[model samples]
Target chain A: MFSQRLSMALPYAILFAIAAWFFYLAGQFRFTPRGDNIGPDFWPRLALGAMMAICLVQGVRLVLTGRDDEPGLTEGFAAEDGAAPRSSLLLAAGVTLTLAYGALVTVLGFLIATFAFMVLFSYAGHLRAHRTIWLSSALGAGLIVILFQKVVYVSLPRGIPPFSHLTDLFLGLF
Target chain B: MDTLLQLGHGLLVCLQPFNLSMLMIGIALGMLVGVLPGLTLVMGVILVLPFTYQMDVASGIILLTAMYVAGTYGGAFTAILFGIPGEPIDVPLLWDGYKMARAGQPAEALGWTLIAAGGGGIISAIIMVALTEPLAEVALKFSSPEYFAVILFGLASVVALAQSSLANALISLCLGLVIATVGTDTTYGTSRFTFGLPILEDGIEFLVVMVGAYGVGEVLARLERGYAGAPVTQTATARTELPSWRQFAAIKWTFIRSTLLGNIIGIIPGAGATVASFVSYGVEGQVGRRKAQLGTGIPEGIVAPQSAATASVGGAMIPLFAIGIPGSGATAVILGAFMLKGIQPGPQVLLHSGELIYAIFASVFLGIFIMCVLGYFAIRPLVRILDFPEAVVSSFVMVFCFIGAFSIRSSVVDLWLMIAFGLVGYLFDRLRFPIAPLVLGVILGPLAEESFLNTMISFGNDWTVFFTRPISGTLMALTCLALVLPLLGALRHWLWPHDFEETPHSQGSP
Candidate 1:
């Protein structure tokens, strides 16, 4: 019961704070309504008010009635019936790679960047064999570039760092 | 004849060497994604959406729809071999199919399941093609008021049928509604929660929310469980490689019956494939199996649920084409793609672009036919992988969950948002909250709100319009009935005697 109190109520309070902060920020919107009745602020304010009211009610309800999900304190995190850490780490790594790849796509160039990304993921991340990673990555990059550039005519950047001669070559020829 | 001619054009587009290859690749990718635990059809679609941006309209859509069909079929592989279902829709299938596998007829179960699924898909696809035109005509009559009623009906059905406590499901819905309000107020064109983060201008993308809720949340839940893979058993039996015609014949009626049931149920928004699959499976069990024979591995039992589950693809598309309103989570993503393509998928499109609609209809049939042919040959090898240790697969699922969340809109903000929802999802899971209602709430919340506001503006804020409009009025009454009838039933059962409630399994008693 005590842990449940900390787990649920803490988030509720923090979320309320965040909501109020957002409401204040919404007030900064440039107000313009040439003819419409409700100004730009109208909906934002309404949302803020409704959110505050609901959150207030939720907080009050939790205080009045404790959560029924009382965990057995004796159950350690590992021994608890559920939980896998490797998946979380891998997922975190995947998110990092996606962001990095997106950020670096222009700089690294599409072909070079995407090839590196795939190779890294297949090898270091997924633990695929080196040869398999190289082959798959090369194939994946080649296919994507061919489809986007030659067929659909969607232009990806020849890329920023110009590390990829292949992308430059493709973009030049196509 | 005109529609058929349009499809001829679509075929020309689809039959392009690159487009055909992409479709095949997408189907394979869909199967791999679906085979993984924790990753859903929606995840597969979200992850692949970015790749399709470079494609033309027809090819892009062909790839996505192919993924949808293939993903649904892919889940049965996991369900049949291992007791663990890859998707919630396959849960009932796991109960019987796994039992059959355990009984040393893994091949038989796999073979029969493929037949049932293919059979159901083909039947429902035909029905969808036949019904799309008439259904579109009906959809043309709907206005904001009618949409408002339909949305309410949809929401209420979710609450009525969701797992866990009704209060919990309602709470999740409320939470979703709250989240849906976070972005700019579309009506007023003002930021609601930007907090100086430019990303908040769009609020949060629904794809991000879905990926976070299902993907990140699944990882968190798996981590909490300390789960490793289940032990692999011997590879499938010879019975699977050569399923007898008689076995196929025996389950043929059940396959058709479940397909019909799935199609009918899927037309109702909020009542998605999971419900259709489970209900069909249970109904078949009650009718076809003796009480004593229920738990044992019966080939017919596997057929009934698997067929019905896949049939939902055709059935679910009915409302999508008819009214432009999506019927389930995956369909919601399809709707999003339509919006991205500048195509509003409602009656106007049906009237003006009937050719395109028919092309899509034709593609659904052809897509299933292709998936069946491909899956039949691949299932033998795919089924053997059921014996792969769960830990590796589980970890892989976790990784995809994270990546899937991040890929939506390619924003780091969504990653944070996803983690936040993952925590929320975990809390909900612990407290017996129904995830589906929350998901449905998020999917349809904006539409519900917009329609309500629009109807108010049109009628001078008169609530009476909801009751006065012809289509809307009936729909409103039905929404009320959907909510009230279930409560009344529970009340009657409570006030009187009910042996069903006495059972321990009725812990999820609504």
Candidate 2:
């Protein structure tokens, strides 16, 4: 019960912190002294102030109710028995994979990085059929490359040195 | 008579081999997404958008309109066969659809959905064709103040109908507006929050945020739950058998009532098909002749929700074409498509591109017919689509997310921002914050700011122009009412906590 209440309070606290930071940022927003104008900072300031008030109301309600307002949220994230640890690991891996793919594309180019990511992701997802995994990844990556880079003419990244050669070879076929 | 001639011309355009093929592909994709749980109609539309960059404006709009029309009808597949609703808009289907399917009437249940969606969608499309022009003619007179006021009304409606707490919704909206203000100020040309990064000067892309939040963020959240759900067993065959004319005549009133109710709700910005379906279900229960038998696998329960859900598609297009405002998240993406195609969808578009607008209307009718036909004969294959595990589906979605993010400006920075927002979206989902308002805010924020700023400048910084102009004044009043009604409800809840039924504060339903 206490943990649920804390979980509810945590969001409000984070919102409050953001509100405070925006308030500080609002101080740096300079206004021009021409023609009685409200200036560029006006909308941001008003939005921030409104956000601060909303956060305060939410904080007060969380304090008074001592209950999470949305049960679906709690139910969705509170984790079922024995499901927490495994899911948590999966979530971490997913985030890491996503970030790694993003960074790798700049160095390894789009096709190679995407193919590698798909294979690893399929394996991690427990698709133990090796032939299926390899075929699907290759087909998916090849289609994406041909469609986006060649047909649509989107200027996808070509990596340095060795990866650049591979990217050129792939694009040459299309 | 001129409208008729123009519509005939539009029909000719729609029948072109290329456009017809695109429409079919769009409907098939829409049904695929709608039958699968966790793949929303909005996400389906967004993923398809990057593919449309190479197509002409008319074909692109047709493809999108086809998807939007078919998407609302496709969710009944999973909602009937399995207990799980494929989309939030299909929740009302679960009341009697799953029950009827389990009672060995799956074919009949599927037929009711087909009839309701088909009949209601066609009627709504006719109404859309008749109504959009007169509305745009009226909107032609609107100035900056009226535009600002209407945008405020749209934002207010979203917050008021939001499933999350009013405060949380407002906070999410304000955050979106702030993010929108990150780049150089449109009015003064001064950078606000770039923090020395050159890329920030161009501002964050709404598409990047949207693809991240709905696609990648959804996948992450599903992973957090260990991607656990019952594997669906497909029992339904290919054929759909509708009720007899006499049996359909018995529920004629329910069909008419729900269709009208849905059209009205769809015209209201922010309350999309999900809310329409839910409201129609509630109203049907309260007023229908078979109220007592609503949850007992009856035809009335299936008819009301499905008709209302489908009718809402036509209703949503009204605001988009008439006044340059999106009625729902899916339409917001359509609005983005319009902007990308360099066609501002407002009164001027009606004047300049009437043929294109008529073509979209024609596509809607074609899409409705094709969707009904496909839903009838393609049930078995669509049901088989659910056999793929959530893990594989989410992984593919992640790849799409990566491509979508990178395709916008081909910037690695955009990809990073997409990942960051994905994490933020996951947090918001876990905490039960509504993401819809955030999306609306991002899409509509700049327009609101530009309008408000322009109005102020035109009126010599007089803020009261928003309340002084006749149309603007009435809209401002409505905006206030929209904001205040929720606060009053909250106050009442606070004062007498036990007065209301203690239902779960569910996310993603009205």
Candidate 3:
């Protein structure tokens, strides 16, 4: 029962803490000494104050209402999951791939990084059909590269070797 | 008469091959995204935004507008045939739409949706064209104080009307405003929240926030669910079958009432198609002669929400073009598009970029026509497209998201920013915070700050100047009303909790 209550109270607590932190940050904002001047900090400070007040009220409401009320907004999606721990694991894996993809895109260039990311993402997504995975990933990456680099004229990272040469060749077609 | 002539000229612009192709492609993509669950029209617009960056402003706006128009109608196909709402806005259609399909009138249900979408869309487009010019004329007389008041009113209305708790909405909105303050202060020339990063000096790009939150974040949320919504099971197929002339005539009043309601709701900031569709459904349930028969596979049920949903598109565009305020998430992205093109939509937009404005208006009509045609012929193919695994779809969305993030400044950091926002967005989504206010905050925050500072400086720091000028005063009063009404409603709910049992809390979750 205490755990249940904690689950309900946690979201609001976090929100309140974040708001308080923002308020502290707002306080750190340097204000110019001009008389009657609302400095650059005015809007952020005002917004942070309002957020803190709202977060306080929300937290108070959760404590008073207890667990009988509908769960806090963040709680519903968790209950809907079939296996929460597994879902979290999957999400973690997805995020890791995403981060790795972001970090590696410039080094591995657009082509190799995207293809590898696509395959890993598909495999993570549990798509078992190897052909579908490779084909769709290839098509998606090719189309994106062409659309962005060729048509849209945005420069993509060219990587360190053969991949860079291919990216150059792709760009040359335009 | 002058409007007619200008509309004709706008028609000429839209007829250019490139513009026409963009419109068609936008419609096809819109329909595809609309039928797929977990993909929203706003996400569709955001994902497509990177491509638009390379095009002339006209083709880009035209493409996105076409998608916006078609998107409202595309979700209906899934709702009516599959009993699954492709998006939140399509939720209302499942009541009667699915019932009609299960009753073996799938074709008829689809036809009603098409008719309602087409008729209501055309009517709203006509009204949008007629209203925007006059509204802009009235707005042309306004100055900084009035602009600040109106923008404040916009922000307030969005926060107050959010289907979630007003507190959550405010928190989300304040978060956006704070994020908007991260760059060098244009007025004071000092950075407040940059924390000394060179990238922070330029400010966070609204597109990064938009694409990350709506696109990557949405994919992450769906991933958390393991893409666990009910799978599409039924494979029964039929062509769209139109009702008889008498049958169509029977539902004329439903169409008219829903269209008007949709337009009005659409024009209100923060109230977009989902609200319009649900409210139209509710109003129809309460009114009309056949109201008692609404939920049991009735034509009125299908007509009312579908028409209003499509009509809301026109309603959303009015504020966007007239006052440069985005009335919905999709319009907010379009606002980003306009700004990217170096066009600030307002009264001045109509004065200086009349051709582009009218061209967009013209595209709306043409889009509605093309959507109906494509929707008729492409239903079978779209259903096949939906059969693609959810994992694959999420993967595809992630790819586009990465590309979109990278294309922005070709900065690897933007990609990280997008992924970070995606996680934040996913958390926010789970937390039931309305993301719209956050996105709008990022877009409108700078403008609001600029306008407020300008007013303060011009008026010698007198705060009352906002309430002194007649137009600004009236707008300020309205903003107060907008904020107070919801608080009063919340107060009532708190005071009379027993009376509010089973009260449906609308989620502006998208």
Candidate 4:
């Protein structure tokens, strides 16, 4: 029960702190307000102030009641399926893979980075079929390259040196 | 006669081979997106936005709108056959649909869904055509204060209709507004939240926030559960067995009431198909002639939510096209599509681009007919989409998300921003904070702020001017009521829990 209360209160508490910090920043805007005009800080400050107040009220209510007033939309639906065994490690790996894919797309170019990400992500997702994984990743990456780069004209990043040269070579065939 | 003639011309435009082809592709893709568990209708629309960049505005709008129309019905197959709702709007279907399917009437259940979607969609399309012009005429009279009030009402309706904690919804909305306030202030040319990043000055694109939250964020959430609850066996064969004329005549009122109710809810900004379905089902429970028989494999139970859900598409388009405010999330994406194409949809759109407006209306009509036909004949293949591996599907979703983000400005920074927001979205989901308010906040925040500022400037900073103006005052009152009534209901439920029976709308409705 105590842990549940803590979980409920934690998000509100964190939001309150963040809202308070942003509120302070809102006051330190670099420009002064012109005559009769509301400053740029006004709208943001108003939003932040409301957020802080709601967080405080929610935090206090959670502490007193030890239960949320109601389940949120996501919470309600998520409960409908019942609790399944969750893998925090899998989630962490997924997040890492996604972030790495984002960071590497510009570095390794779209084709190589995307293909690698797809294979790794599918493996991380527990797809054990090696042939299926490799084949799908290659075909998927190639099709997307042609569609976005050649047909749609997105000008995807080609990366540096070897990767760029490889992408160019592949595109030359297309 | 004039409206009919205009509609005829619009039909002509839609019947053109290119436009017709786009519509067919859009409908097919929309059904696929809706059938998949990981791909949402709105995200599907968002993924298609980049592709629309190269097309003419008319074809672009047609494609997106067709997707919007078909997406509402595509999920019913999964809901009935597998007892898995492809979208939140399909949850109501599961109560009777899955039950009926289990009771050895799967094809009958599907047939009910088809009639409800087709009938409700067409009726609401007619209403949307009739109502949009007068509504636009009224909207043309609105000023900055009124616009701000309307937007406030939209934001408030979203929070009120949120199926969870109101406080969390409000906080999510506020956070979205704050995100919108990032970068240089549009009015004063002063930098607000850019910190020192050059990319921040141009402002965070709402599209990036949307793709990250809805697309990447959903994938992460599913990944955390190891993609649990994959439907293992296809128990029922995919086919629709249409109800007899006598059966339809018996539930004609259910059809009318649900379609009308859905259309009305759809016109209210921020309330979409999910809300319509839940609320209509709830209402049917209270007032339907066979209310006691609901959830017992009854046709009325299936029709109420399905009809309302489909009707909402037409209902949602009215505000998006007529008032420049999106009535639902999908319409918000459609609004974004318009803005991306250098078109601002509002009253003036009717005057200057009347043909385009009519074409959209005609497309909705034709799209509904085509969607129902597809739903009838193509159930087997659409359901087969569920057989694909979750990992492969999720990986492609991530790639589409990345490409979407990167293509926006061809900048790596936007990709990082999208990834960051994806994390935020996953966090929001785990914490039970609804993502709709956040996305809507980002989409509608600038309009809210700009209108508020413009109103202040026009009225010499007299904040009361918002209340003093007649229409703005009335809308402000409605906004307050929209915000307050939910809190009051919650309070009553808390203070006296037994008095308030658990309505369908109050449980997992969003």
Candidate 4 regions with alpha-carbon error over 4 angstroms: A1-6, A72-76, B234-236, B497-510
lDDT of all predictions: 0.66, 0.83, 0.84, 0.89
Candidate 4 C-alpha RMSD relative to the actual structure: 2.1
Runs with alpha carbons beyond 4 Å of true place in candidate 1: A1-174, B1-19, B159-187, B197-199, B216-227, B231-246, B289-291, B381-446, B481-510
Off by over 4 Å in 3: A1-7, A28-35, A67-86, A162-166, A169-174, B233-236, B502-510
Model 3 residue B14 lDDT score: 96
lDDT measured at residue A53 in model 4 versus the true structure, 0 to 100: 97
Candidate scoring better on TM-score of 1 and 2:
2
What DockQ would you assign to candidate 2? Answer: 0.45
Model 2 alpha-carbon drift over 4 Å, by segment: A1-7, A29-32, A68-86, A126-129, B235-238, B501-510
Name the better of 1 and 2 by lDDT.
2
Question: What tens-digit string does per-residue lDDT give for candidate 4 at B159-179?
Answer: 887757888889999999999
Docking class of 4: medium
How close to the true structure is residue A158 of candidate 1, measured as C-alpha lDDT?
70
How high is the lDDT of residue B197 in model 1?
83
Model 2 C-alpha RMSD vs. true structure (Å) is 2.8
lDDT of 3 by residue, B62-102 (tens): 99999888888888888888876777778778788889999
In terms of lDDT, the poorest run of 10 residues in model 1 chain A is A69-78
Considering only N, C-alpha and C atoms within 3 Å, which residue pairs clash in candidate 4? Answer: A72-B164
**CA RMSD of all predictions:** 5.9, 2.8, 3.0, 2.1
Estimate the TM-score for candidate 2.
Answer: 0.95
TM-score of chain A of 1: 0.70
